[model samples]
Target chain A: MTAREEILSRIRGALGDTPSRPDVPRTHRQQGVHRPGTPELVRQLIDRLEDYRATVVRVAAEDDDAIGQAIADALTVRGIGQVVAPPGVPRAWTGRLADVVVDEASIDARTLDRIPAVVTGSVVAIAETGTIVLDGATVCGRRAITLVPDTHVCVVRAMHVVQTVPEGLQRVDPRRALTFVSGPSATSDIELDRVEGVHGPRTLIVVVAG
Target chain B: MSTFLGMPGVPVRGPAADTAVGHLTGDRPFPAAARDSLADTQLRRNLAHATSTIRAKRAAVVTEVPDWEALRDAGSAIKADTMARLPELLEQLEANVVARGGTVHWARDAAEANRIVTDLVRATGADEVVKVKSMATQEIGLNEALEAVGVTAHETDLAELIVQLGHDRPSHILVPAIHRGRAEIREIFALEMPGVDPSLTDEPAVLAAAARTHLRQVFLRARVAVSGANFGVAETGTLTVVESEGNGRMCLTLPETLITVMGIEKVVPSWRDLEVFLQLLPRSSTGERMNPYTSTWTGVTPGDGPQEFHLVLLDNGRTRALADDLGRTALHCIRCSACLNVCPVYERTGGHAYGSTYPGPIGAILTPLLTGLTGGDDPNDSLPYASTLCGACYDVCPVKINIPEILVQLRAEHTEAHADRHRLPTAEAAAMKAVAWSMADPARFARAGRAAALARHGIRRGKPLLPLPPPLNGWTASRDAPRPSAESFRDWWARTRGPSS
Candidate 1:
């Protein structure tokens, strides 16, 4: 047999049809483990993120339009005009920001350099820890968009947010690339001084959608 | 290009006689140096600020989960059990990996590990290999080994690439280029990157773009990829790499041949064991609940990724480290980097001061065990005295490796190794002999204490002693000597209260 086949056989042998098993189907079983509620998890996640020195803002699900407006306002406050969005980002979200030019899909390094903020949707949010999980889907583009922009505005649907890390890990598909962002990219390497946005985004802004 | 199997052996040096010969005396004590380091204002400020922020961040997220402590306990237990059953687990892992069409090679030390990897690359006829920031490869100096054989090793991790291009050593465990600022990175890119934009500024984006352009070519072209595992699951023989950058995915998937060189300490008993480490590692090292990317693969995946796979299980003195009852806990390190984050000495002197790929608290313990103190004036010997035994490393270690305890143990070993060279003189020995004689008897101790009190009265009021004579000079160099009381506490109590009436 091939190496791959042999590896599978060994894994099966090692597992040995153990009697104890999880309740849910194996694929779905990983994602839906015990987690905190959306609102509570979001609050805890934001609090922890702030401890990491990440800038956080809370918005209600009813204020989905306001989430977009907040991104535009943050950009204006930072004195930047251009914003980048992933291809699948809701048009309603970007349509609300009139003053800022919303650039979508074709956001390469050169283009991202011109953009001041990137607002995207999250794959999942772990409320227990206040971490935003991004797969290469919807508002979260390839890892580059969130990393390249100075400020990242991640919109989390309340329903998608989970309470714990284990629950969050289960939901994420291992085959596809995923990025778990807790706060802005930071380092304390130089004389042990905490510096933000060294290689990744210097500022991380979380928009919690109800 | 020549393979590692056919290359000449490179001698390794220990830390003692390498750079610290002048500072240390025959006493084998770091009392003076340790005291002086405490007074360094800049270092204190830097460490206090850095550690506090990460501490606060880690605590906030960690406390969010009710199971956080349980996870940490589980992670520690799993690593302990794995270390205990390493021989059997490794054999099982090797058999499983081999069955999956992947090759398994056992390397005894850095030289052998290097030779195996270099030979594999040569056999593949690949001149360049794209690497995903594997510390094991760095520890073994695989890039330099590959370079000697005319094969180039390209580091795809942005921080590692910066470290490589700058000709600098990694200063931080997670962020290797933490010592360098953007301005310095811009300068390196300008000087080193072949097609770097001439007008590139020191802006983070500009620097990142330059690196992206430079490495993109290598990622697409390189046929061989080398990596190190965060954990190796024994049950399924699966290897996991947890990273923030997506570059690891590219390197793992795009390359035709994937070779992973993992230290024996990385094994976990089962996939369930990963649950504990996955929770502990990210929170401790990067201050995240979970990392951005965690990739796990077993053997090979038909047409999806690398066609050929190899796992090189590296011992390189790990077994020797495990043999020591007090020191075996050092092997339990997950390389989460929490100890490095909190170490006061590492924060100031930086990673280069340790002079090994493994730096900071883990380095202090592991380097000496791996390289030993016997080799020709080796630099690894001084690593034991590099810490102040502050116990900060022990507090943050997820596996609860008693770093301070191991440091003391290593210090004792170092003294024994150089006992003849560091022997006390006849006069000093005789003085100590007299003191020991007096200290052993309670009546003599009381008499000495009374004499000390009498001596205190004669000490000049305005002028305090700055330097003590000979043996005590080390203590006086960095701190003030406390004034002795004019009367002993016992005598004062006796006089004030009339014999306990």
Candidate 2:
């Protein structure tokens, strides 16, 4: 028999003729906010993002220029001159940068790595867990653009912030590849000590625009 | 393999050698191996420090949530429900994955899984593949298998990289280099890591930076990446990897071909279920509100990540573990290693003593469940006895595995296994039978008790309980076998008052 058939038969035989299907009681905190990214939720999201050592700066809810200026300021403060911005990210954001590379298909992995930073828009942010979700949309860019660079400056609009993981899940497209950033890349591998920045971007500056 | 009790994976009675499979069984019995680790003071200090530090962090984070218990109950129930319909869910997972332009392969055992992976890596024509830290891959000895076939697998996780560079076995699940101090880690990187700076310091941040520099080029150049899934969603064909570092993202993103060796038990029923697990896992494992990065991908995202995605569903010895009713809960573990941090036994002897890729309280039950205990000379037979029966493991278990109860059950199974192989019962079993016989009648009970009181003449009540004769010494090895009382309770009662009519 094929391995699949054999394994299935084994599970069936193991469970026996009548298997008990226990009820999954999901009484846990599933939904905290019915609406995505309210003002209150955005404040909580900033608290969480800041707690993880990520720089969170807020702007007026619909001020596109202010969002761009905030992103530029975060990058400039870090002395990062060049950045690769994915398509669909507001051009005004990278317009102030010294060198801006569009996250196009032609940007090879090696070249992407050479670029010091990446700026992209996020799909959603979870306030409770301090997480930012990036679906592989044009706004979020491809997974490689965000990963290969040393610095990631992600802009999460206030409306994109959710109160809980369930809320974050509701906003994401499951078919699209998703990256959840709670903080910059970190490891507690050495003596269980939390050291931020390993392999992924060292600096994660969250631009929480209105 | 012959079926026992109509279960295809269940081995028949007698010395069932087929059950002794994979890296699940350790090189030596746990007691003998623990003796070596116990002697290493460095290991003891490292284990003590790391476990205590993580324990505090876990406790602090866990208390922040009001519905922690409710979440754990839901986590446990979800796992139970998934296991009950594993075959159906697995089929659903396969169908969904295949529908998304991804290929799925089934392996009945470790050997087959190794062959499947080796062949896939060969097909890519890559001499080396970068890896994300995965327990399933470690359990199957994937690295060694790849090396034998001329494929070097570079471990990308800092801890795994440390273990790989040092040519050492992982001592902890979450922190593979938990046993190695920063000094030793610095030395390993300086020597093993090509192009590393000569003056590398023992500081964690410095060590981390060195590893980043060492692996950056490798991650960019790698053609194939292999990973293990924390959760595989059957609903959307999505596989999630919860990691603190970005190595997981690098491997999941940059590679042209990505292969994930996921245990068949990893598949949950739906995408929404991740909400519960994502909340439970990071807090329980790393004591963080959330891990730094969690990447979830469906099969083959065009122009985004790996275009060629292969999810190899591994059944190495999981079906054997599922064959028993009470034992099947061992499979519910999310590889969080929460139980390990709180386990008193693991804190002292360290992970190497457990012998398997999985160590501590979970390994004590999981290894034996995956690979059945052969009564005579099997190292796994000693695993169930490696615990102090402290329910700390069960208490901290995110999925509520009841590891202490399983340990007790496995001990009984071990005794039965031994009894089946020998004509004479084990010494403990024989002693138990003798006591049962002695207590049957009142007159006989008195005589047996009076005979036991004779030991008071030579042995004192409060004396240390070792250096006994061969069979009795086994009990004293871990426990304080009390001396027989000078006067029996019955005799004392008779003298003080009157014996019950």
Chain A TM-scores, one per candidate?
0.75, 0.95
Q: Candidate 2: where is the Cα deviation over 4 Å?
A: A33-35, B1-22, B464-467, B476-481
For B1-501, candidate 2 gives per-residue lDDT tens digits of 543455444432211113333466678999999999999998898889899999999999999988899989999999999988998899999998999999999987778888899999999999999999998888888898899999999999999999999999987788888999888899999899999998988999999999999999999899999999999998889999999899999999888999999998899999989988998999999999999899998888778888899999987778777767778899999999999999989999999888888899999998888878778888889999999897999999999999999999999999999999988899989999999999999989998888879866655454443367879777666765577888888998898998667
Once model 2 is optimally superposed onto the true structure by TM-score, how far is the C-alpha of residue B125 displaced, in angstroms? 1.0
Q: What is the TM-score of chain B alone in each candidate?
A: 0.86, 0.95
Q: List the residue pairs that clash in candidate 2.
A: A61-A210
DockQ of each: 0.09, 0.65
How does each model score on lDDT?
0.67, 0.87
Misplaced by over 4 Å in model 1 are A1-162, A168-210, B1-53, B373-378, B420-435, B454-467, B489-501
Model 2: how far residue B136 lies from native, Å: 1.0
lDDT tens string, model 1, B1-501?
A: 211221122212211111121111112222333444356665455456555677677777666555555565666666666755665677778776777678888765577788899999999999999999888888777888899998999987777888889987776677787666666778888999888887799776567667766776676577899999888777777778887655676677667899999987788777666656777888888776665456677787554457799998776656556556556678788887888877877776656567666778988897777666652245666789889899999887877888999999997787667654555533445677789998999779778878888766444552344445766565555555566788877678778987645
Error of 1 at B113 (Å): 0.2
Task: Say which candidate scores most in lDDT.
Answer: 2
Cα-based TM-score, every candidate = 0.71, 0.96
